[model samples]
Target: MSDFSATGYQPVSVSDPEVAALVGQDLPEDAFREIRDILFTVKGFDLDSYKDRCIKRRIAARIRQLGFPHISGYVACLAAEPTEQLALLEALTIHVSQFFRNPTTFMVLEKKILPALLRTRPAGRELRLWSAGCAMGEEPYSLALLCDELCNSPEQITIYATDISNDILKKARQGRYEPHRVAEVPDSVLKRYFTLEEGFYRLNDRLRKRVRFFHNDILNDRPFHRVDLILCRNMLIYFSPPQQEHILKTFAAALVAGGYLVLGRSETMISETRELFECVNAAERIYRKKADDVKEDD
Candidate 1:
């Protein structure tokens, strides 16, 4: 498995051989299935779509955190506590975000993507952008800052940010962040867009009003339509190949012809969806949706 250290997930070691065996063996298959089924039944979270080992590690981490001896105990806890189910969902859906998390990608968006989209936008039509899996609103807020700079008028742009976690969405709506979260924000831009209050940098009302936050599951919910650009960064790496492909196809259908799609620095268009989009910036993982006349891979 790839190192999840970046997300603060550390491999746990225990002295108890049985507990160690549970972690080492990725938990018994039946126990893991029970956990998955419980999450699906209670929260509508489809654990089957996630990478198996990654989900296992998260579950094991939770088990270790709660001081559970084994997987069965954790399963019982999940069944009994509603809060624990939300906690497990939060654990499973790891969200690590900051303003302009990847500088180059944002630079590309500000300098190249936004300009091109503005020039090509049809008269009387709003420029629509979606930030899928927008954790705590940084990605979409970052886009809003750029759009605020480039667009002729505020009405020209419409930004929609969505995440599966309602709790995270509530935080996003609050539009407040700690100092570390806004570290990447440029000094001048920070002064203009945010107010430092009580040690928290709060995004100003004008910019806050620019974005619409929704509780959405990309796998199961309807995607935004007629979008000029979609930024789904760092979130796709959690899913299985088939789920990833399903999401890519959904993005393809969501975007208008010649629309742009920006993925994470680590993610790429899978083989099945490659023909749906032409690579625009390989280093930045930016792609453009192919026009309807273009032929798709069989």
Candidate 2:
């Protein structure tokens, strides 16, 4: 029902009643499930964990991009071309993200959460952070700059940034952004952390080296444990309810006592995950892991 034009490439829509009828009437919902399941089983990527409405929109985008008439045509293309699987994965996970995407949330994190974590940890100790679904490296890079100011050395603060799409991860690793991408960053901070080119900005090696990028599927992969903070902002809204609950539990397992977890301002903890964390700044969607709970892997 949904389509994928938002990826920046407008696909030419195709109309074929025969193909539409086949994809709709003959294959039915079972066909969709099979295609989704095979993506994980054969290719080791799980697309089915996402909400169906989101899945359908992405599939529609792929269909249009490849000039397929309907699901049947798209399925045929996938069956023939292995590379299409990667394309489909990118389409599904593609989201709009930017540096300091939400200023108030980052402000809350800087003013409240970071200070509390620093005070609790022992002096001269290393700090760990995870940036889930760290699209194009902006979120983790933003965190790295903040940590650089607080910690003794850039090496002391390790930011593990993970995303499901390798294509996006590659872009993130490059640490290069067009002018529009850096528009929100203050000019002074920009001069300190990034080198501005004719039209693109390149994040300095000091900031980039601190963030270790990984091609991780958060839905199925094990998250890094014993992290002092996990920034999973804006990613959960795309997943279904059960998936969200599972991720929150995994985040809980990964955090140390009194660790902080940050989400998008629009996102909040589900009723099921409320016990694991207490809201530190509800207005900014920041939560701290309960000090008393034992760490258990999900």
lDDT of each: 0.86, 0.78
How many pairs in model 1 have backbone atoms within 3 A of each other, for residues 3 or more apart or on separate chains, i.e. clashes?
0
For model 2, what is the error of residue 150's alpha carbon versus the real structure, in angstroms, after optimal superposition? Answer: 2.6
For candidate 2, lDDT tens digit of each residue in 162-233?
998888889999999988777788899998989877778999987888899998888788889789999998
The CA lDDT at 68 in model 2 is 54
**Cand. 2 Cα-lDDT:** 0.78
For candidate 1, the per-residue lDDT at 190 reads 95
Candidate 1 regions with alpha-carbon error over 4 angstroms: 1-30, 37-57, 61-70, 76-85, 293-298
Q: Per-residue alpha-carbon lDDT of model 1 for 12-47, expressed as tens digits? A: 556665477566745666777898889878776677
How many collisions between residues are there in candidate 2? 0
Candidate 1 overall Cα lDDT vs. reference?
A: 0.86
Clashes of each: 0, 0
